[model samples]
Target chain A: MRESDKDIIRSLKIFSDVDERLFETLVTAAYAQRFPAQVDLIHEGESADFLYIVLEGCVELFASSHGRETSMAIVSPVSTFVLAATVKDAPYLMSARTVDPSKLLLIPSQNVRDVFDQDPAFARAIVTELATCYRSVVKSMKNLKLRTAIERVGNYILRLHDKSGKADIVELPFGKRNLASILGMTPENLSRAFGALQSHGILMDGARIEIIDRAALETVSKPNPLIDDFRS
Target chain B: MRESDKDIIRSLKIFSDVDERLFETLVTAAYAQRFPAQVDLIHEGESADFLYIVLEGCVELFASSHGRETSMAIVSPVSTFVLAATVKDAPYLMSARTVDPSKLLLIPSQNVRDVFDQDPAFARAIVTELATCYRSVVKSMKNLKLRTAIERVGNYILRLHDKSGKADIVELPFGKRNLASILGMTPENLSRAFGALQSHGILMDGARIEIIDRAALETVSKPNPLIDDFRS
Candidate 1:
C-alpha cells in the first residue's frame, strides 16, 4: 500500500483499533478509484462486492420506485457507506451515484468479512459503525414523519447554518433541486416551502441562505437534538 | 435457563448459528417480562440497558418530536428491537410501547456485547441481524420519502394482503389510528386517503379490508421490491 493510503486507512475510526496484521491485509486488498460526476457507484439489488469509503467529493444515495426517485443521503468524505450490505453479504439496498468528481476507496467485501471474523476489534468497530448508521437513519425517518415539508426546509437550513459554524449565511452543499429531493419534496414544493419560511425570517438567494430570525425559525422548525443533531 | 426461553432463543434466526456455550451464556443473562397493552417499554433518549426480543404479542416503536408523535414500526413476535442501540451502547432513538399484552425477553446489553466479542459465530449472527435491520430501516425510509400518504396507505394494505397469503380480505394488525400514525398521516388524513383509494377499488370497514381490484390499487401504490418488500 502507498504510504498516503496507509495514512488514510490508519486514520479511519473503523480501522483505528484493528490489529496491524489485519489492517495490512485489509489495506492490501483495497484500491482507490476516481469517478466523474453522475457515475453510478452501486445499484440497488446488485451483489455487494466492495465496501466504499469516500476519500473526496460527495456521493448521493437514492432509491427509485416506478420511475420516481427520492434521494436518501448525501455521503461526504472520510466516511463509509453501504457497510451493512457488505457485512451481511447481501444485495445493496440503495443505489449510489457520485455527485461530483469523487475519489473513493473500495475495500473488498470478502476481505472485510474475513478480517471481521479474524479480528475482534474490527468486529466491534463494525458494530459501532452500523449502529451509528442505523440510528442516523432512524432520526432521518423521524424528521420526515414528524415534520412538515416547510418545517423540514427550516430545519435543513438551520442544520446547514450550524454545520457551517453558525454562519449568518450558509452556502448549500448541493443545488436546490437536489436539496429538494434530499429534504423529501418537489423542487416546486421546496420553492414554496422556502417562501413560507420567509414569514419566520429566512431569506434564500440561490445557494446562499440568510437566517434573519433564528429564534422565529427555530420555533417553526422545532429542531430537536434527538432528531436533528447528528453528533449528539 | 428455562426450557421455554431456550426454545424461543433457538427459534430466532439471529440465534440459530450461535455457539452452544455462548447461547447458554446469553440465555442465562436473559429474563422475560410481560407488559400490559399501551405500556411504554423503552423511551427515547434514555441509555439502552437491555436488548429486547419480542416473544409474544406486538410492540410499537415510535418517536416524538415537539408535541407530535410518529409511529415507526409495528414489531411483532419473534423479532428484536433496539439492537442497534444495545450493540453500540447508545441511547434509544425511538420509544417502544406495547400495542397488546406482550412478552419480551430482556438481555443485558453488556452480556450481548461480551458474547459478541468472545464468540465469532455470535458476532457473525449480530452482523447478519444488524444488516437485516439496517436494510429494513433503509426500506422504511424509502417508503416514507418515495410515496405519498395515500400511496403509503394503499401499498401498506397490499403488503398486509400479501403477508396474509394474498387473501381478498386482510385483518388489520392494530387500530386504524395507530396504522395511520405508522404510515405518517393524521387519522383524518388516513380517512381521506382511504376515501381517495376507493376510486382505486379498495374498501375498509373497521379493522377489515377488502381489495376489490388489486391490479388497480397496485398501479396507484407502485410497490417496488427495492423500496417496499422487506424480504428483498
Candidate 2:
C-alpha cells in the first residue's frame, strides 16, 4: 500500500479499526487526492459522487443563503465528513472546501453503499456518523435561535480551548469573519462580541484566544448542549 | 392476514411493490394497536420502542419548546412514521398522538434491527426510507428559512394537493394549529396566510382546501424539490 493511502485509512475513525485487508480493499478502490487550500470538494447543489476521509489539514462545511456563506462545521484530521450525502447519493445541502492544503481519500459513493451492505459494523459506524451529524445541526439551530453574539463567541473560544486539551491559548480555526458566519453573526458583530468577552474577563486574546475565566463564561452562557459539546 | 392490514399495506408505497412474502413478513411482524384520539402513541424523551405504520386516522408529531408545542410532522394512514428514530433506538425526539381513533402497526424497534441484519433488500428499503426522511427535513428547513409565513402556507397547500392527488381539494390531516407549527409559523399567521391566499384565488372551506388556481399559487410560492408527492 502507498504510504499516503495508509495515512488516509488511519485518519478515518470509521476505517481505522477495520482490518488492514479491508483497508487495502478500500484504499484500492479509493484515490488519494490533494485539494489545494480553499478548493471545494463538494458543492451545495451538486450530486454526491464520493465520501471524503480527511488525511491531513482541515475542511469547512458551510451553507450559502441569499448569496452569503454560513460555515456549518470544520472537519479536521481523522474524521469522515459528509457521510449523509455519500450514503444517500443526494445533492449536498452545503459546500465543502479545504481550509488548508489537504490530503483526502475519495471513495466512490457506491463503494460506501457496497461496504454498508456487506458489513453491519460499517453500517453501524455510518449510522453513528449520521446521528452525530444530525445532532450537530440541531445544536446549530438551537444556537442560532437562543444565544447572543458575545455569548456564542465566548462559548466557542472555550470549546477551542477544551479541544486543545485545556491549553491557555489556541489559534482560531478560521478568521474572525468565517467564525462569525459559523456563529450566525456578522463580522462586525463578531469583532464587538470578542471585545465584549475580553472586557468581561471571560476570554482574552489577539489572534490566539486565552480562556481567562471559564467558570464565569459557563455561568453566563449556561452552556446548553450546543455550546457545551461539539459531538452532541 | 386481516383484511384491514392487507388494505393498509396495499396503500403504502414501500410494501405495495414488494413481493408477497416480504410484505407478509413485514405485515405479520407488525401488531395492530388502537389508540383513542389525543392518546399518546410515543412520548417525547421516552425510549423509542416501536416503528408505527399508521393504518387508520392521523398522528401528530410534536415536541415541547419552552412550554409551547412545536409540531414536526403529520403522519397519515397507510404510512410508516418515526422509522429513523426506531432504527437508531434513540429516545423519541417528538411525541406522537392520535388526532382521531387511530389503528397502527406497532413493529418493535428490535424487530426492525433484526430484520435489517438478515435482509439486504430490507436494508436497502431502510436506506431509502431514511434517505427520504433526511431529504424531507432538509426541504422543510429550506422552506422555513427562505419563505415567509404566507409563502410557507401557500407551498404547503400545493404540497398537500400534490400528495393527495387532488387537483381541487385536499383534507387537513391535523388542525390549523398543528399545521402552523409544522410550517414553523403561528396559528394566527397561518390563518392570515390562508386568508391572503383566498383573496388571491386559493380556495378554503372549513377543514378542506381547494387550489382553484394552481398556477397562481405555484407562481406566488415556487415549490422546489418541495415536500410534496410523499408515499408511506
Candidate 2 lDDT over residue span A46-91, tens digit each: 8778888788888988765444356777788767676777777777
**Looking at model 1 chain A, which ten-residue stretch has the lowest summed lDDT?**
A223-232
- Between which residue pairs do clashes occur in model 1? none
Candidate 2 chain A: 10-residue stretch with minimal lDDT:
A223-232
What TM-score between 0 and 1 does chain B of candidate 2 receive?
Answer: 0.83
What is residue B153's positional error in candidate 1, in angstroms? Answer: 2.3
Best by TM-score: 1
Q: How well does candidate 2 score on lDDT at residue A19?
A: 53
For residues B107-207, write the lDDT of model 2, one tens digit per residue.
77887777666666566666666665655555555555456677788878887888777667888767897788788777898888888998655888888
Per-prediction TM-score to the true structure, in the order listed: 0.94, 0.78
lDDT of 1 by residue, B13-110 (tens): 77888888888888988998889999999899999999998999999999998898989999997788999989878888999999999989999999
- Candidate 1 lDDT at A178 equals 87
lDDT for each residue of candidate 1 in A111-226, tens digit (9 for 90 to 100): 99999999999999988888888888888899888888998999998898899888888898988888999888899999999888988978888778898999999988988888
